[model samples]
Target: MAITSANQLELLQTAEAVAREKMIDPALVIEAMEESLARAAKSRYGAEMDIRVSIDRKTGRATFTRVRTVVEDDELENYQAEMTVDQAKQYLDDPKVGDTFVEEVPPVEMGRIAAQSAKQVILQKVREAERDKQYEEFKDRVGQILNVQVKREEYGNVIVDLNPGEGVLRRNEKIGRESYRPNDRIRVYIKDVRREQRGPQVFLSRTAPEFMAELFKMEVPEIYEGIIEIKAVARDPGSRAKIAVISYDGSIDPVGACVGMRGSRVQAVVNELQGEKIDIIPWNEDMPTFLVNALQPAEVSKVVFDEDAERIEVVVPEDQLSLAIGRRGQNVRLASQLTGLDIDILTEEEESKRRQAEFEERTKLFMDTLDLDEFFAQLLVSEGFTNLEEVAYVELDELLVIDGVDEDTANELQARARDYLEAQNAKAMERARELGVQDSLVEFEGLTPQMIEALAEDGVKSLEDFATCADWELAGGWTTVDGERTKDDGVLEPFDVSLEEAQNMIMTARVMLGWVDPAELEADAEEDAELEEEQEA
Candidate 1:
């Protein structure tokens, strides 16, 4: 094969045909041909020669050239492609070190082996271009629903044809034991589009929670029009699911719109999900209220939310315990997912018993620490004094308000409580000193003696050590691992330190130790405030 006038037009024709078949740009195919021709030219000429090729997009003519760059004597490593500045004077009137010399070269005549190698190069380039086209086409289509046809099944994974591209619905992404034969049309959520070595991989999923949301968006006109928005969705695919929706228009009920007239809209989505039952709940700004709606078909007596831990405790009637938990805890699990909070469901009786136990524990603390009798301790506990610190520091009027407690009695009670707290603090300070706690940490202003002792026990004995600690490390936090939230115990957590307090204390320690500049912090805060103002505007 040769680049002759007869075959020059044929090159462009072939490029167009190949590009049309691959659904890629014709220019890409032409560029691939040029690269393959250049590679072959290098083989025909010296391997060290810098050979280049260009194809005219209009005339379909191939141009080949040899290129050599003039460089400094010491930098002229490639004798065939690079020349010294003096050596290039013959080709130019005045050539600099960085000047390039180019001359036209005859196109290579392709032999059997060369032609075969060029063909492989062109194929690889075309395949790469095709993959890039597919990736760019589908990358933004993620979280969307696509109607596709099943091509085949490899192992348990179903391969679906996405018209111009192919997608794989992994076994884990399928709803239940969904089995498909060739040519089965199905709707799937475009979970991800990834560029891999083999090609662009379009991962499809039928079990994703977003799939249900998209389905509703398609089935409900209000959702599609943005009159109602899907706030959250949780699914046990091919089984039960919960969807929370909010309506921007007051007249439009999001739940009713999603449910549709006579259950037609939701039924469409359910049929597509292989009979997955869906519970449409009205979305609420209040987390507890939303959670109550999420755990439907069960009555909630009370909800206790621990915001720092992102956990919630729900007290239901004894008979509703099983209903709230659902079969095998699926209801609670889905509700937790829907609300983004770890949930603990308990019966009313259990909550009452726990509250009583807490009350008794507080009563005992008052009796032992304040040296009060059982009845007097109970009275203090009932008056909302949980610890000696509160009793010691509380207003005298608050203690006097208790029935049968006079101002003198309140004064005496506060005095005894303060004495006990001081003694406990002195003992804690002694223990901390024994454990090598430094005065820098002890006199940090925010940390009490008990807090210092806890820090020392946890190997944080100095201000420097405290400065290096993270806020979560000192205030305790919940970590989500494998989809389950686990508690991380903090040294200062026992002192009732909040995350914000821990952050402030650590920053203060860092400033005191000269590890952080207060001025820089203030500037950063001002910049953040300005950015927030701009965003609001």
Candidate 2:
């Protein structure tokens, strides 16, 4: 194959120009041009014929060929593209099966219609190549900050020209107080890149917590150099934000570093955020101290934490309640987000009232359920026995460790607690049966009759329903109602079962129903955990 036309070199120059403009391999451009020529040649040579074209990248020569495979007469699949030895001898002196034979044909001129069609093919190929490049370039850059120019705005969405291609900064992703015009420059974080039918969607975000952190990293040199690190960030978009920072070096004050000289650095970030208020709090490994810092300006009277529940009760003065809670509960909400804990804010008076109510309820529950006097009930309450189950299943030594409680008394107390529990369970089982609770669930030790009744009322009538419940739905956990993750005031009340107990109950029900493989329960989990610890050691 050779170039006969004078303009053959022009093809090579055009391919190079398009490759450079599109930032693609020149070989790819030549290949796409080759395909476009092949499609054009087919129209002249009849669409049913196997016509191919090759353009030499160096010589700019275009060659056209009608291709055929040498095969036995009986094995020919297509009459036009396959030939026997009788026909093959005309092209090749000796041709074997599976060998291709090409016969050169005169190059067809690119007519008006063919030129138009070829232009479309080349454009489509270039667009696809560009999309591939965009995907490759932006895929790894996701979650990183980038400076972009607002090229266009479509229906409130800012379409920014990225380093390579166009990206979408959606309306919801923009800060609430910030609006953009065409050619307006802004800093955006690459949230995600999705391969869609149209092209790679490079989604940008201006309101992400990471975006703010990135801005701080730009404004503050200490964070960028690794002397200080951002531990966590929580944002209310353009209104207010909280960032927890820690210093790796003992001498560097992380908060002061972020605040900069006379609040200049922070004010720069705030200006970029459209006047968003920022709280740069020092992060501490001590959760109580960190939480106290997270809720700044409003002093915390006390922080009562339940390590088991990972919940915190913050008590503030009556007048400071509103400040601690912020406007529309923003302060506590941001603090919760920063700390990753479910925070309950109350006044000191409310804390006292709640404590008294809880104590009285527990004491009364013990006095009424067990055949104990008020003094004994109060004694059990003071001994940190919250419920009858603790009394029933606690080790005898634990009960004996309480002062004035002998082994005989502990035994008697345990017996009475068990009896009371058994009686309550019997009543619950009856109630659950009346409520149509499954018998398999009834046999599970961890589930109380009241819980069974609740499950039954909530359409969980079968073991499968109970098994498929999400850990959050089964046990209480965080809920996200809107775009943000905030607690749903009331979706489903949680079952008061410890995760281990819930696991045991679900395993028991499934095992009883033959839903789980029994072979999987070969090792005691505790023993397995200990073995894992030993292996780690």
- lDDT of each structure? 0.93, 0.84
lDDT of 1 by residue, 101-197 (tens): 9999988899988889889999999989988998999999999999999999999999999878799999999999999999999999999999999
Model 1: residues >4 Å from true position, as ranges?
A: 530-537
RMSD, candidate 1, Å: 1.5
RMSD of each: 1.5, 4.6
Cα error of candidate 2 at position 268, Å? 2.2
* Model 2 per-residue lDDT tens digits across residues 375-453: 8888889889999899999999988877789999999999998998788778866876877777766665666676777
| Candidate 1 least-lDDT 10 residues | 380-389
- TM-score for candidate 2, please give it: 0.83
Per-model TM-score on C-alpha atoms: 0.97, 0.83
Angstrom error of the Cα, residue 149, model 2: value is: 3.3
